[model samples]
Target: MSSLAYGSFCATCCNLIPPETEPLACSTCAKPCCWKCAREPAESVSLFNAPAVICVACDAAMDLRGGGKMVPKPPMEQGLQRCRMHPERFLNLFCLTCQVQICCDCFVVQQDHKRHTIDSIEEVYRQKLLETVEKFREIPKRLKLVDWEAVRQVEENLKIIQEMETRILGDIRQLFQQRTAIMLNKTAEKKAVLQKTKDFVDRTEMQHRQTLESIQGLNTNDFLRLQAALNERCESILKDVGQLQVEPVRWDDIDCDLLPSCKLQPISLNLPNGDAAKEKHVQIQLIDDCGIVWTTTFFIGGQSLALEMKPNRQLDEFHFKAIVEMSHSSQIKVSGKSFSFKGFLAKNELISLPKLNSGGYLTDTGDLVMRLGIRPENILEESDLLKALLVQQRKLNSQLKVENATLKDQNFILRGDMLRVSSESQQNKETLETQVVALTRRLKMFQHNSYVHNQTLQVRPQTPISPVSQPEDDKEKLSSDMQMLRTKLDEMKTSMKAMNPFAIGSFEIYRWSKDSKFYSPQVASHVGVTIYIIVQPNFACEKSSDVNAYVCWAKGPKLRCQIFIEVVNEFEDECVREDRVFDFSKGTSFTWKSVISHYNLFRSDGFLSDDHLKIKFGVRPAVE
Candidate 1:
């Protein structure tokens, strides 16, 4: 036989060996391998009849062993491959920080992996595979529970949406019903007023026809006798017509836009006195939605009475007063623990009603009811009206003169007060500054002393000189003093700010009315400088009414201001404007009258729109 030569290389170590030396060959891969690189056949491979050793590579290549022919393992099951960056080395470690598999070379040499936490791939695989299998097994149950919860949530949300929709729809319908009721009530009121006017007109017409017939049938002698009476009757009829014309039954313009509705709360009243006969005074109050209170006080005497009506709150622009005579017939009723008053009210006159023991014409929930009628004697002649006008004008002029004088006095007082306050503020500021400076100097001295103490202690550690506890004590005391000084300084600064007079602020603009005259609230600036405007309605005046603007220097130093007044139209672009420069010195308030005509304010083609008079005011410091 030819000498056995080294034929094939061992599959495990790839070493050449002699065939005659009986080198092991793998049954699966048919690769020759050295004895150290061989492994016994699996127990399931009993058909081979004899035990055989296979090369390590052939054993590794077989994924499922023993029962069948060699089956190659999948790429994933072949363990970690070489790293992409460094193909020569196998990827043995996983980077926890980077979440990537890296070889030993990449982990040790690459800058990117320097800070990354690395774990062996086999260990990570063993942990992650078991966790993944457990999680995979739980997926179905978790998905089922999540799906059920989502469905339940969807159902609940749908129910809530439906309920909200129902509630909103119900609210809308209720609002409409309420609005309709209000409209119906207002219509009925208008109808009643119109019916009353119609009845008055019919009665007057019938009387006039009867008088004309009597005049036509009268003889010359009778006519002369009745002429004076007939003339008086005619004049009375004409006066009635004029009065009707002056106060017509006209519908008030209603705004369709919705406004916040206020509940009609019951008005609380003070306990009533025993009876109208014995009571010396009676008070009645009416409060509006805007918190305005109108009070009427009745001073009762044996046969005479005085009624005083006024606003509970002080008004800036206008005041109201009415003087009237009371008739003996005016009376009050008290029964069932309720108070009721009924009286006939005329211009400067009142006729009392009969006292009721149990019941009377007690409207307004048995409160007070006044069925007042104008007395015929209240009518005035043309000459009398003229005289009244002249008297009113003279009264207003005299009142203005007096007010001007009072304002001058107030101005002088304010000037003195301002000077005193300034002096006090200056003194307080100086005192605080001096205190702060002294405290700062003391704090610096304490710090210097402590530093010197610390240095001496450092230099003379063995010296018998007791460490000066005084420096530490002094330092703590100085720090506390500094803190107290800071607190006092803050308080002083706060007080100074409170004393400042030039600060500016604003408030809400409000509308008010008295005796059919419209007015604006007194709008004041931060320094207590204020302004208000009034529109006075006068049927007899040339322009029907006069608009006035008042500027008041209620407090603070004298100021020169430019005041701009505008009447804007809600429906139109055009507006009526007036501008004036006024010097408000001392505590004087200046009034500018007849700045604009009332006719222009109320005219259909003018500034008033939607029955609303929009007034705008612009106040600025006047140029020197």
Candidate 2:
């Protein structure tokens, strides 16, 4: 036996195989070979040459049928092959031209297949074998190049995807950090804003509590107004918070309903198991949102009371009186005035006690001995002295007012008399001037009469009976009347010369005794003697006199007189003056003013038990 060791052999253990066998065989075994063992077989070779090479047993089966080696098998013998005409048999061979395979029966009998060119099993098999070998040789190189290119492409795609994924992850991380920072900052800002909001709400609620307490003890229009204002502020705060852009986390805490509710109850110290005593001195504290507390006292009768207490502190049962006072320093006259109420906690109501008779006395001490259930008339009567004093003061003030009015009337009459006297003197002088003019005309007429008589005497050649012709009685009567008229005129002139005008000067003093009139006696004397003349060219002037002077007691020592007269009476209608004699002899002061139209200056001395003398002076015009 021989082996074919070169063609299509399994490339291992070739030395153990034999050559020159018709088919390759195993070198180590002496068995007939088919292609599986002959080409590179570990067996004996067979002695057959068939187109489709096979083992000896397989070749012999073909020879038993015919001498041809190209015998075909049934269609089913090949995988997925079936006879075309027979529905159950697969037609295996495919014809390229006719585009169909034929079974052995069809080749012999089918009319469609009889005229077509046919390919035998050996011819088709050989042609297919060469084509298959050519295709097989080119497929691996092309596949290898394609696989390498696919690997490169896959690597490039994976790298790009990896870079993009990294960038996306980095962006996501930075975005998360940025959002966190923003959220944290906003949270801090919101907390600060919320704190402020809480503070404001707290303050407003505190104000509401204070106002409510005030309304409890004292009910007034002012307190009511304050309460309304507080309510409005609370509402405004709530509305403002509602309009905020951010939703607050802890808004419920500031709700007024959730906050403390306080009511004023009579603190009864007389409860059982209690050494009952009224709260004699309690401190009233006013708290703000900032935790600052202001301490004040609520005084009732002579004792002080408190309004609020700490939350944790115990409230001892006690009954105390309280008086709340509020002041507004805006009214001009009534700023420091007080509104007082004497009240005690009776049952639950605040009962007001009767007012004391003593106006200035704060409380009735004797009323302490009188039981709460009883009213003491004796204490009420005991306070009568103070009440009577008040009444007496009122009466004395009325009398003093009446006396002052009487003095004012007397002064007015005196001033009226002066004005009348001055006006009468001026009228008298005008009348005298008119009378003088008439008297001159009358004298002229009398002289003419005498001249006419003398001329008649000269023309009648010395008539010698003048004693017999003249009426002596008529002449004597005329002379007597003239002498009386002249005497009356001389008396009028003397009276006009005696009437002098003067101005009043001013002086202010802090203290005025009962002998104030005596102290300034020289003032009155000067009023009668020294004349005060004001030279005012704008107005009608009586006489050009420079005796007007001023004296002010408040000036102390450096008192001097500077007189002025009108100069350049056009645009500059002002007075120019030089200092004259400064007189300080008249009780260290002296002043005068022209008594124009008989105007007199009068003084009012305001005297009271509570206050020192306050005086005022004025020169009033005559009523007439």
Which model scores highest in lDDT? 1
Q: Per-residue alpha-carbon lDDT of model 2 for 373-476, expressed as tens digits? A: 11112333224423544676799999999999999999999999989987896687567667766765665665566566567656755337664445445455
| lDDT by residue (tens digit), candidate 1, 1-624 | 011112334656766554445444444543445544344444555356554443365453322224333334323325557678877656757899988887766866688899778776655887899999999989998999999999999999999999999998998788878878877887788678778888999999999999999999999999999999999999999998877632222112232224322222222222232464445666666443334465656555444334554555444333222222111112322121111121222222132323421234334333443321111112232234335546767999999999999999999999999999879976876676576567567657666766776787567545347555555566677577657766765665555444443323222223334346555554536334566665554444332333443333445457776666666655546666776777667655464545555533444555433334556665555432
What is candidate 2's CA lDDT for residue 410?
96
Best by TM-score: 1
Candidate 1 achieves a global lDDT of 0.53
Per-model TM values vs. the true structure:
0.26, 0.19
For model 1 the TM-score comes to 0.26
Question: How many angstroms is residue 506 displaced in model 2 relative to the true structure, after the best TM-score fit?
Answer: 18
- Angstrom error at residue 493, model 1: 37
Q: Which ten residues in a row have the lowest lDDT in candidate 2?
A: 368-377
Residue 289 displacement (Å), model 1: 14
> Model 1: residues >4 Å from true position, as ranges?
1-162, 220-624
